[model samples]
Target: MSKGKAHAALTIAGSDSGGGAGIQADLKTFSALGVFGTSAITAITAQNTQDVTAVEPISNEVVAAQIKAVLDDIRIHAVKIGMLGSPALIETVAQSLKDFDGPVVLDPVMLSKSGVALLPNDAVEALVSILVPRATVLTPNLPEAAKILGEDEARGDDAVLAQGHKILDLGAKAVVMKGGHAEGETCRDWLVTPEGATHLDAPRIETRNTHGTGCTLSSAIAAELAKGADLEAALTRAHGWLHGAIQAADQIDIGHGHGPVHHFHEVWT
Candidate 1:
């Protein structure tokens, strides 16, 4: 057994039966980063790399109970939230985390890679009003950021930075505007905080196996935070780690369509 301060993180998210994204990816990332993972599943997604066929959210009471159970027992150093399927779920999660002071990495997973809306229209308001305020770090892709702000997708650096500041205005302590959806040779993720912005850029590795990139990145940051890294350090570590995972994605084959990043890429070899 490993001897040291045990790092644990709680993930409040959906479950993907295909083992590519959602809770599976969150847990995989936590384990890979040497953090113990706990979970409160908000929804169950019958999803594969190709599509999300069906989604069923757990009862709000059950979701709350799961979070309570974990917090009542374990020492969760950080929390990563993803895929809350409804307004009520978002409110519940926000209430559940109200007392905890640990870092909260909120990945606003609005749409699937195939363009299916994971979060509905009504719930967006609730997420903004309730959960966004509590987030220590809000991770949103280009389209997700646009949807959150009810604006057109940011096109240039100036537009993206303007939107990032707008999102910070919504009460998030920080925002990571992912550049994956943008047309670019280099994916440049902007880490915008109250102080300023930092550019996290990496060469775009061409690969179809990017099923859980967002989930993995956010969870990995939470994992790093659980290990006591500061906000910028955590984001930097997660970004670098995800780049490696995506680069090594072709080492394994999973689905017929977009496969998952290699969460254990460093260890599997």
Candidate 2:
């Protein structure tokens, strides 16, 4: 490593006591992609693989302090954000990242893997107004898109594209709508930008080890961005990484309900 080389990526998110999602997953993804990972925890959750029992959000001032400390000391090349518990936390993060010029990957994390709601209902507006505009790429699942647009309609490629446009209209440079939760053999993800939309299709891996897929994908994208790939290229590489992670998931067992993906699949090779 060079003396002044920038090799760090920051994750602003919540803590998962289960170690399957949020900051835990983000840091694991970063390390798997060979980047130093830093974190600013927004909230703490008492969760297991099956459910989230409790949540306690950290103070806004502490969140701001963590961001400032990391930014001032480390050379952060990219950022991946997830699970802002409340409107106040969202606004605090927005203020902290107002001048950061790195690649920002925003994962619109609304619910836990166990179907527990992680974000507050009123925080959606604050996230759109404060953080969406500053994101280099925003990753949202179908349900999150529905919540953002305030619609109860079923999501397809066309509907997701329209919602992506709505997200872009809100000020994101690009939008990635993940179709894993959709019904199909193929999990199709769309990356919509000002130029046009590019579709990424991959066969959905049928497994119970999908607890942190969203967090892993976004963090992998940020790691690729830190390595100097373009937006589309980063997304493509992230897709590949996530596919491997899922395929190798069966090699280990962590929790009884839904386990985490294998982040060290290539380490022994």
Candidate 3:
């Protein structure tokens, strides 16, 4: 068995009262991948499988304090960011992460599982300006990509790639535009960078347990990066891991609406 001080991954996001997405999902993904997890919650979400009824934004000072409390003491190898609930929080987190010289996986979580907007319209500009440029990798679904690109380009793979390139122009080092919501038998996730583009296509597993998919994917990517994988390798591994997670979740039932993925599907002794 491995024995040493556990390397850490910090997740800066929101609290999911349902324990399926946001900070909860991030922590679960980190733990399942054998990384010690820490968090700086930016919001408190009254959310479940069906909807998010309310969101209470955490104070920016407190969010910065949480980030400092972790980074000051622990040797955090990677960081995953999700769900900045407001423009102030976005600016706060972007500033905090600017000094964190580590692999940072950013999941642009703009909406809830039940199609509720988690981020306000005003915060989009802050996120684009402050956070996107510093990200080691940015993960955004088709709709979120559309929102960021200021158009609905979620219809075709080529259009999605075009939008991904547009996002790259915004300054992210790498962009992984997810194709889960796209109409197809296979789910294709595209990874684009200045070097070129790589495609990860997997057979779509029909299952309801996809609540925390974006969080899980970004956390898993951070996990792989913490374990010393490069951007392409990390994205590939995270894609397969999440595919397995979804497949393993097929037999389980967590809620009447979308359920949580099986993040620990590969656990063994």
Candidate 4:
């Protein structure tokens, strides 16, 4: 235990070779926000802005061991989970985090922007049954919310709020119902709990560089939570930061298709 170590948040997710999403995006967001970052990689992905060519999930034993190694030693303050490919892998993560007392930010990553599936059909059940109940805050896009609840994708505000409550009924303490898929000029993401709901609304920027927005936002929330921000405050701050990042995404040109947001937007200028 170092004397002056920063607040630490652990990201248990896949590795994106393109450095846009998953472990790479999570770590980048943590570092950008002055939080110490740690990771337990569940899978390795061969992807770019254009496509996800291949994916190789780490064995369950290895994934569990990675999580154990970090939890046993590091003083973790928060955890963000993403992209567990199978039922066994989801179960492994749930079991590994069973004893963790800090906030768990669960981002239900189902597919890439290029239409490549990340979580399989059967694994979605395990995620809802196992991990969703354990989540401190479940962050799910519109389609993901529908998938979790076995309903059609939510479109308008009323439907979105309705689904958000349904997700809270699944036993998550709260949910961030992302409105990226909704048809509107403003992107409104609801932070819904059993208590009530608030929103972080920003004007939707027209850009093709939204590759890792979900991963980045979830990890940013984790980082803020590690720094002792309450769930509402964390969502507000993370949303503002991500909006800035997305606005500055065009400043950098990395890939051919959907490029990454400028994670270092605050620092690199």
Candidate 5:
């Protein structure tokens, strides 16, 4: 390890009491990838892997303060944005990052697998108009992409590239469309940059412990970016890391429901 310096990645998102997702998943993934992690919680949820029972959004002022506190003191190398609860949060978060030049991975977390709504309906508009353009990399699953684009659906091999471009037009340096929702033996994620597009595929690991895959993946990408990886390299490495975690998910039984992927698979192996 380096003598005094540490690569830092900040997660601005919600908190999951169950610790399977949200800031919990993000920070855990960061530590697993050897990055110093910080967080500004936008919402607090009484949630387990199976269900999200309650949600309370923090005040926009406080969210701004938490981000400022970290930015003022720490030299954050990357920032991962996730699960902003409202339009106010979307606006404030964008304002906070408007000046930051570091890598920013925005995960458009719209719903919980248990059918809980993470981002409010109105906030979707703000996310598109405000945060999308500022993001260094935008990550959205199939359903989330449809919601943001006001489309009914996005599936199929061609839908991946089409959806990625439509999202790229929404304003991001690049887009990574996650394929977990699509039906197939293989899950494909496409990375679309201005120059071109590249895709990665992996056999889907069937399990209920897929609770926090999105948050973990985005946070891992931010961690790699904090370590100065290029966009393609960061996504490739992050994808492989998430695959390992998911494959090793059953190694522990944390909760009774969907459970969580093993974030420290590499560390404690």
Candidate 6:
């Protein structure tokens, strides 16, 4: 057996009480991908497949403490960041991660799939000013990207790609725009870096089990990074893994509404 610490990936997000998304999903993704998972929860949500009924942001002190505690003990090889509920908490997380040196996948989650707002209205500026600059890769869906770019909606590929480059100008090492919300038969994504942009396309899987897909994809990227995969390889592996998970989503019966993807599809298949 391998000795010493296992390949570690840290997820700084919220706790989904329903056990299908947020921290729960992130941890599952890390484990399924063969990486040890750690978490520092920023909020607690009483949510399930249907909706997020409640969200209680954790104290800033405790949030910082959790990050510190994990970093102090384990050598974090990669970091996956999700939902910071407020501007103060966003700053707190940014401050806590200031000393941590690793590839970070920042999932700028704005709202739950059920259309409940997660990030506060006022925290957008703080998130843009602080965390985006530090993020190794900022992953944002269409709505999130539109909000970040101060647009009512980001329309076509040209507009979406333009806004993506604009966000990258804010200082993230890279920007990945998720095209799930884009209108088309095929799902599209563009990875924008200083060098240029790479287009990635796949047939969008139609299923209600897309819950926590964003979290799973980002965490899988972190896991791949923990295993020392380069950016391209990491993203490719993560996308493939997530697609497989979605393809196998209906294998389990979890809840009444949207369900979760099979995180260990690779292992079982």
Our model 3 lands, by Cα RMSD against the true structure, at 1.4
RMSD of 2: 1.3
Cα miss at 206, model 4 (Å)?
1.0
What shift in Å separates residue 193 of candidate 6 from its native position after superposition? 0.4
lDDT of 6 by residue, 145-246 (tens): 888878867788888889989998999998888887888778887888998988778888888888888888888888999999988788888888888898
Off by over 4 Å in 3: 1-3
Say which candidate scores most in lDDT.
Answer: 4
Put down candidate 3 lDDT per residue, 97-125, tens digits, no spaces.
76889998989999899988888899889
lDDT of candidate 5 over 67-136, digit per residue (tens): 9999999999999999998887898998888779999999999999798888889989999999999999
lDDT of each: 0.94, 0.90, 0.89, 0.95, 0.92, 0.89
Give the lDDT ranking, best first: 4, 1, 5, 2, 3, 6
TM-scores for all candidates: the values are 0.98, 0.96, 0.96, 0.98, 0.98, 0.96
- Cα lDDT tens digits, model 2, 1-269, are 56767588999999999998899999999998888999999998998788889999899999999999999999899999998988888888988998899999999999888889888789999998889999999999889988987986446777888988988999999999888889989999999999999999999888999889999999999999998899999999999889898988888888898998888776745
CA displacement after TM-score superposition, residue 33 of candidate 4 (Å) = 0.5
Q: What TM-score does candidate 1 reach? A: 0.98
Which residue pairs show backbone clashes in model 6? none
Q: How accurate is candidate 6 locally (lDDT)?
A: 0.89
Report how far residue 240 has shifted in candidate 1, in Å: 0.6
lDDT of 2 at 207: 92
Error of 1 at 212 (Å): 0.7
Give me the runs in candidate 5 sitting further than 4 Å from their true place.
Answer: none
Model 3 TM-score?
0.96
